[model samples]
Target: MDNNGPAYHEMMELHEILNFKTLCLVKSKMMSGLVFDQDLKALMEKDVKQTTAAIQDLQSVYKPNGGIVH
Candidate 1:
């Protein structure tokens, strides 16, 4: 096993997490537009921002052959 990269199982798990976070980010952004309450909309926006960051971090760690997919 290579020391610098994640194992196969770990990479698969990370890929799943990245997909989930990407979905959450997209949903939050879309739903925020429909939210009437300012507080709820703000919260959803915050979630979008945080989820975006999480996806980026996950991509950084889960690179295959030193490159991200997107």
Candidate 2:
């Protein structure tokens, strides 16, 4: 069987791979702690807030389609 075809096992494997990568990133960041000083932390927080607001704005446009399932 060609690996690129839309097979159920292949899809499940791809999902598992993506989830493992996400877990690795989260674990690595948690282990490192904050690598920034107070000023940098404030700047990062501001950026995060702005990015979050932007995402919410986009979501608002599509939210009526259906709330996020997860």
Query: Runs in model 2 with CA error above 4 Å?
Result: 1-5, 34-70
Clashing pairs in 1: none
* Least well predicted 10-residue stretch by lDDT in candidate 2: 61-70
* Top candidate, metric lDDT: 1
lDDT string, candidate 2, 1-70, tens digits: 6543445654565555545545554554454456457666666556556555654544443323233223
lDDT of 1 by residue, 1-70 (tens): 5565556777777778888888888889889999999999889988888888888888777776643445
Give residue 44's error in model 2 in angstroms: 18
